[model samples]
Target: MPFEVREFPEFSWSFSRHKTLLTCARKYGYEYYASHNGWLYEADETAKHAYRLKKLTNVPLAFGQIVHELAEKAVRLFLKHGYVMTEAELIEEGRSMLNRAYLDSRDRKQLWMQKPARYKMLYDMYYKGELNRLEAEDYRGRLHVVFANLLNSRSFQDITTRPLSMQFQQAEEFRFMTVDGVKIFVVMDLLYRDLDAGKWVIVDWKTGKEAENDRSQLALYAYYIMQKYKARVEEIEIRNEYVLSGVNRTYQLMEEDIGLMLEKMKQSIHIMLRYQLDMISNEPVEMDEFPRTEYRQRCETCNHKEICLAQ
Candidate 1:
């Protein structure tokens, strides 16, 4: 058989992608366009470097990911085997995962450079060459708090104590829906049928403090849920489970809320399309067409700063 020729993935819209575009157009280009096919052995050095930088993670992001993973693990255990991981077990596993990442970034530079997709290269270590000991300890403490809060979270209790039959959708699953002919991606942390409330509950696990965009993000998820599940505004319940603080904030979304979210998405897509060379082909223009942000401070923490700043 002949070797298969690979093509770049089609462009797609997502909440995170929209945010990235807003944050820095150049970064958006590198992440979604320039890095395309960077995995190919014959790819350019610039594309390869950008792709490696794109995979860089920091302490906060890594912490949130680990917590989400553990949360998914807990849901799977209870759903599949009628078991929930103990708090001690959750903390132990979280710490171990974090430690491995830390060690990888600290000691496995050659390995990470060789296989950035498989190995973790933390942003802090990559740029600063070392992490502050005090900060590392603080994140470890935060990890413990997140797991403890997760166990005590209302969403977790509802998931574990409620009937397994009430579960409506899989946790942490990649799902998408189309609006105005544009594909929108959504990954619900936890979604279930609330028999008592006669509604579908969408839980978003938060490992860090709340941000202004949290409600809007959930609103977008609600839009997808409504479209895909044929759920009405009243039939859907939105929740932000801030595991770090053990706060479960529920938002009562109206049809108007989802409508606004759709409009925002449309506007965002329109802006992004301006930077593309061919909307049909999802092709991006020259690198210089996507300008870097005027704000210099943001670049300090940007993953693509190495290649970006070199310009």
Candidate 2:
């Protein structure tokens, strides 16, 4: 007897278009789907610590809390002094915040490991240089535009707008399926309304040099959003903020482009279905000629990198 292959509808909705595709299709099949790669949310250790401490009986969130506090302070100081905050000052504030948290009687060494000095040093590097560099050079002149979308009172906004009100550390998960009946779950960094256009915008934040060939990810995401909500999607935006370099770039989705991508997604899914059918029928796998993908420095940080190897 054979087990049944799982399949589900693709009409689900989500702020995260990326996850929806991933959840719905085979990972390799959806490799070209819109991608959200970056360090803004992934780099901050403080938020990770803070989230962990939620059930730790007051063990205080570590790096992210301190970093946010320090960053808020740094932003304030930047506003007042009209100068860049030095790396050392940010580190000092972060250290002080960490110390205050660690020394709290309720937080001492009970549920958490003492943060290593190296971690603090790494975070300082991320803040003082990496994040700053990207923001200054690549992402210059878009702060207000980005902030407006992030700070909206609405539940969903684009990455550019939402980061202003909430730190990149926060994310929302959305689930939907493709037309071919595959369930997907995307943990979106941000979603927003394009007020001027009266349309919903979906976003994914990126941290490095934007990939010219990665529009597929965005396109698939946009198609899913349109399919799920039955709303006119004005645009799909991807905010690539180079945390290490501090550079930012925004990509907007066009109508024709999305249409082409939707077609591509359907083709890919059918190809994947064939692969699944072949596996079930005990057919020999016709592997790709050059099977191995080159390693990317970013791969070290990818959640799916380990699984990629097995594939």
Candidate 3:
């Protein structure tokens, strides 16, 4: 296999930027530099909580990945067997696949995490001399077979046969090039294609429910696809599976919609960057505490609530 390396100058846009700017640009600016300056997560408890989640690549975000895997597998199985599965069956298979995948892929990603020593020490402790390299391979291969079997089961008909074909292609670091000379980094969830239409689409799988109007976060994905593939972004979908009624709703992307999002992201970067430059020129800066916001019903189950309430 061959891989190419590309570089985007020292800049990027993230969804957090869009939200932060919407809430408070001054806060965005101070936090951006404070974050990169290496003192933000350490001094601020909320920042620390956010940082930990972002760094969690193992089974942390596994639920959605597992769901997608099972759905896709079900589609394949349905294609082969001409059978459709209930949503409940698909969800159950998804959980099983997730556990298997976590155990199997743990070692492959062990080397790549920003923190390797953490897992390395854990692996060292768990390994037994009796099980050699061959045993490890057997363990991984068996799990892969199990996961594939679950994915190819019959219940995933709807998502599989749908006109939209999607795959998750992500890296801890994303290299982006823009007309403004902005190089961006992101952790992406899904990249989609309408094979029949030959158009590019981006989908982000959300475990929680979202409003139909809530699209600012996914707009960054549209921006990246437009720039990276040089193809007109036909649609941007945010699949929120964790809805109040447990239904998934998709929003279509219009040119104007993405344009506004980019404008906001750009403004956010500008605001944050300007403040960061000023702060660098100053003596020193301390990270701000996570500002308190109203706790919505949706936020009750959010992983960040503990830290939010603590603040």
Which candidate ranks first by lDDT, i.e. highest? 1
Model 2 lowest lDDT segment of ten:
31-40
Error of 3 at 310 (Å): 12
Give the range where candidate 3 is weakest over 10 consecutive residues by summed lDDT: 120-129
Candidate 2 lDDT tens digits, 1-311: 69433221122223233342344333332232111111123534533333222212211224434433444454444335645455555555545654454344223333233332223222212222232334223322333233332233132223323334432322233454645455454444344545554555554443334566455565666666677667554544544343323445556777888778667656545444543324334232233321333545543433333344446
Give a tens-digit lDDT track for model 3, residues 4-78: 222211245565555654554434433343333222323454443343333333232344445555545554555
| Number of clashing residue pairs, candidate 1 | 0
Task: Give the TM-score comparing model 2 with the true structure, all chains together.
Answer: 0.39
In order, the Cα lDDT scores of the candidates are: 0.86, 0.40, 0.45
RMSD in angstroms, all models? 2.1, 13.2, 10.9
**In candidate 1, where is summed lDDT lowest over 10 consecutive residues?**
164-173
Screening candidate 3 with a backbone cut-off below 3 angstroms (N, C-alpha, C), the clashing residue pairs are: 11-183, 12-184, 73-151, 85-155
Top TM-score: which candidate number? 1
Per-residue lDDT of candidate 1, residues 127-182 (tens digit): 99988678778889887688888988988888777764375575545588877788
Which residue pairs in candidate 1 have backbone atoms (N, alpha carbon, C) closer than 3 angstroms, thus clashing? none
Model 2, residue 1: distance off in Å is 26
